[model samples]
Target chain A: MAKTIEEINEKIKAGKAVVVTAEEIIDLVKQKGTKKAAQEVDVVTTGTFSPMCSSGAYFNIGHTKPRIKLGGGRAYLNDVPAYTGFAATDILIGANALPDDDPRNRVHPGEFNYGGGHVIEELVSGKDIRLVATAYGTDCYPRKKLETWINIRDLNQAVLFNLRNAYQNYNVAVNLSDRTIYTYMGVLKPDLGNINYSSAGQLSPLLNDPYYKTIGIGTKIFLGGGIGFVAWQGTQHAPNVLRSDNGVPRRGAGTLAVIGDLKQMKPRWLIGTSMLGYGCTITVGIGVPIPILSEEILKYTAVSDEDIFAPVVDYSGAYPQMKSDILGEVSYAQLKSGMITIQGKEVPTASLSSYPRAVEIANLLKEWILSGKFQLTKPVAPLPGVESGITFKPLKERPIED
Target chain B: MVVSKRIVLHFPRRVVERPIVYRLVKDYDLEFNILKAFFTPEEEGLMVLELSGEQTDYDKGINYLTKAGVRIQSLSQDVIRNEERCTHCGACVTICPTGAFELDPLTRRINFYNEKCVACVLCIKACPPRAMEVHF
Candidate 1:
């Protein structure tokens, strides 16, 4: 009863397609097994809405009335800096960029209140943001400065060109220090008082499509509110991470460089967030529809919170550190239950990733599939899935200047 | 006639040294849970407390506190979740100290259980849409 992509599309065309969410697919497979579930479910919709630091939006600001050349350093949008290095009018805004008057250090250690992420959120929410730029009056461009307000509608081309997203999997964080640590992972209560994780678990796109055969270049997805595509293999895509018998990555693996038209996105699907001490990040809402190609694909979609696990690491030191405190493996279900025993102490668990939003995105994609409004893309290029040893190295470890 | 209510209890300096909270349970036969407590250097005490018991015992507990100069205020106060603004992302579900927020497994919707909310305000800032608001 293995279904092909064409067969699924035919079912969708006939308006008789059976679609299930990543959560529902879990039960369907557990009861009927992969073969039966593959026959029953044609598509499994997955989603995740979490803060991704490697995200940015580009805009073709078009020609200012006097053709002002943006000379890089002095340009801002709604009090947030825009990378003017792109072109005279075209500018890029990184989600993590902070405003000049943010008053970060002026306050307590962690409280980075707002910046580019907030501006992006406001823009998506359909609010106007001030756009200011200055360039020493160039003889060729002939403009010194410009200051105006622009909304998404005014821009000729506004696109969300995120470089990295849909992280295959992530770590669970626990702070063992005496003081509360504010991190992009959320506020960590000290003394292993709490644990915070940031994955939608079963609903996450990369989790459902453990192997990128079904989710690769040109794969259609729900980016923000509008349909988008996986532009490329995301930066730091380690297709080579170790996997469980289930074929799901056991560590950080592949990611996505997603892109979508800004005009088609909704404010609810995107947000700007400020971590009190951890700076800023844009919470991106992404949903990818996984068409059940066969029994194998069905099994991947069946991953549940109780099934997928992450290691708990200590954030008291520099992050992304390979060494972990080895708090042991725990499932998303236990984490969501609100507490887990770390070092024999009952520590509360929290998640920076929003499950409700992820579910909403999944359901939204489901509706699109049922209504035949969205079509699933067969990957043109397969993403790497095996263990790749291509470790990025910094140019020569810093040695004494001999 | 058992009931539960959340209230803010302020103890003056003179009463700070007294074990009034312990006395409420021993003398009045009432149950109390302290959600938060702040003991000032000046010996003043502030607490967000929930008390439960039979109507008679609860009344006696209130009487004992008032007679001892403990000022009390009810916490009808709550955090407001703007229905229009909430996208039901379930971000608050995991962070709530009191398990006030949870996702409905069947519908995949975030449910706010007010009865369990201690108003720690963790979700207020966590809410991306600025949907969760606190009103004390």
Candidate 2:
């Protein structure tokens, strides 16, 4: 027997049924409306914490590895920091320290992308990895050197999408006609001090779609217009294929690749292999760890105080339901009194005027969904602005609330 | 010991048209302290400066710039301020790519810490009033 609407509703409520198509989503949205549509179905939330950082590990990796504490070394001498303490061959790994004591486990910012289960496997496997991808809303001017860098330290395969290469060759694009024609030149590897590949000479790696277009002397490259480029790369390549310039087996193959300004491609990463004849492929060599040199010590300094401070905030069980899919489509005007929460505290009881920010954030959540940039499984709370004024003020004098 | 330091500056030509004719002077009156600022003739929009302060002062300024919105870039030592529009609200006081700006102790005016700015546009974008500009 076919399932009745009530049975379907119960199944969805119990998280047994999944909406597979846009039509189903529309039907569900129409049936329940906005608020309840969320509750009827599974709504994932994510919370973010300010990152915790260290000065950096100083080390030298030859046949034998030697390590040194970064804090105890001479900062600079004769206008140059001495590199005598360690070799430049050390691999500097940026790490995020999770709060071990807190029962409510939350990932620190920049350490991992968001979306999906909070479990380590889910995060490492790249499920629901959170990201904030933005495109120029209105046709605006592009810059000649608006560079974006994605440092690939590990060969971990993940889904990468929403790629765009914008150009500001001219000062500004006042109108669609005035838009500078962007002629996407070739990609470059400054480390190699040479061009890697050219858009003209290389086969168009761009996924053929109307949204992807060239404008203003081909100065700006917008994929899918606001539409973006998506690709996946992860095939078992030969382990020792990649090596250092000296030809020694420094590290594994396909571990690091830097994407300069390519108006034709969006900056994204996705796990899995590509369908035949789609997306450009690039190989990265994880080469021997670059030793930490004395002169380069300052480069690793955590200039911002944030690099030293750990966040004091925490996130827990839902105190506010930003929206209730079960409530059906309620207009913003109908957004009830108690639909959102923060830090495990209920919204209504807290009676904080900042609750509206949650609503503003709800709109951001909807936009995140439409962008298809990431599917989150944790509470991705926006990092509230923290003030670290120039003049040092004690905690009591600081303008912030824990 | 005091010495005149040689500096090479790359600045925008439109605002700083005459590099040689116009001396690079900071409102704070910083001179004979192992620091000198000058606009370069080769690059109209570029300025070069040399500063000799107790090393810690440089570090503090660089830290301030990184926090206030200055972008620390690789490849070159540069400070690029776009003059097309400068609201001068003082966000750059903290957002300098290298912590190059300071509030004058008495006048409360913005002072340039030439050796500290790294040319990051964090302040330029953060400026709600849209007064400052960053080139690189």
Candidate 3:
């Protein structure tokens, strides 16, 4: 049997919809079978909470007193540079942007305690932010210098517009070098002292909808603890990749570009993160509700940690050189068990993503649907899938003349 | 009763040259394991070590250190995890040498055991949220 999103929305409106988290749907399918579970369940909510380097926010801070033209000017939010190339009073702050005085890697294993991400988190938390700008004088907007304190509530508009997020899968990073190395994957101890992986696995949004069956452009979702929408197929969207028999990508594949109103988001879900020796980013919480339109879709949603696998890649050499070399592949079940055996050596594993927070976000999204406060939307268009023959490519460095 | 306690000793510049930790073993009959020590000539010094001895001897050893003008504090007081900032990502669990962090099997939340922490400060950098802080 098959169901339509409209039918599911009708049930949600009538308070008759049956909703469960992606984790719960696994056991449900095991007990009731895919066919029965699909018929019985209306929605399966998936979640992931992890540091995404591609995230950032843009804001319109409203016109300044006497009008300062900031479109082509320099702007700093809490001493971190922001892109002011848009309109006057509008600025974009990337999560990875660092302050001018940040020593960065000059001091080995630098402490990037604060950056643009921290500024965003502070703004969302309703704290005052110091805005400093220097503009070239203009005829219509003649003000040259401006410095003020702004809050999210007083901003004309604040929106989180991430270019790429919700990675389908990622590599498990380990160091095989002689000494410890720091990376975006956190610190990797020497000789595989510890393994670090970041992904929600079965509970991940894109993993459940691996083929982009339902999740696509304009699909409403829970972003940073607020209602948001998938804007487009994310940057570096590589759908053509190795997959297990269950259709889940075996490596980092599809991604989503999400957008949401920053005013509605909570600071808890949008947290500032500083990776020692690496840089700063934000940990964003996102949840996507999958409507069980068919038994096949339900079966995909039932994918568990045991069936999901991630490649273990050495960060010291292969990762830095962009070589596709993997030490081994391990299941999320094994990774989550705290230990994984690679090269016949028992290695302890850790997760950069918060599973407990992912569960909470999924449950919260389920509650929103059950209370009729949220509704599932049919995607306006589908993301390029395996059939599209789209493959992610690396940059080709060439001579300027060529 | 025998007890093992990790403590930090602060040496003022006047007593910087004194061999204070050696007296804990010779005079008080306590076993000391120095975890970290830093001192410059004619300057203040600091040492973190775990001392194990009989309760009476341990008290006497601490008393002797106080008489020597060396400030004493618990080693656990040096490093701390900010509970409000911690998201329980388990990044500190595997990196901790003493297994001071554990993820609850049922709740999947991180449970920190400060008593087991040796204050190695490995978790201070590993934590993504910068939750682990070192006061020293």
On DockQ, the candidate that comes out on top is: 3
Write model 3 residue lDDT over A1-402, tens digit each, in one string.
899999999999999999999999999988998889989999999999999999999999888778998999999999999999999889999999999999999989988999989999999999999999999988889999998998999998999999999999999999999999999999888998999999999899999999999999999999999999999999999999999999999999999999999999999999999998999999999999999999999999999999999999999999999999999889999999988888889999999999999999999999999999999999999999999998899999987893
Candidate 1 C-alpha lDDT tens digits along A313-367: 7787635454535667787888877779878898866677878788888999999
- Estimate candidate 1's alpha-carbon lDDT, on a 0 to 1 scale: 0.81
Q: Better model by DockQ, 1 or 3? A: 3
Over 4 Å off in model 3, which ranges?
A: none
Ranking by lDDT: 3, 1, 2
Worst 10 residues of 2 chain A by lDDT: A167-176
In model 1, the Cα lDDT at residue A56 comes to: 85
Candidate 2 share of real interface contacts: 0.00
Which digits, one per residue and each the tens of the lDDT, describe model 2 over residues A1-402? 222334433544454543321112334555665455543443211111101111111222222112223222322211112133332222221121122232222431111211111111122332332211122222232211111221222222222121121100001000112221111111111211111111100001110000111111111111211122222111211123322232211111111111111222222111111101111111100000001112121112101111111111111111022221121111111112212232342321111011222222223333443344323221112111112111212235557788
Residue B103, model 1: Cα distance from true site in angstroms: 6.5
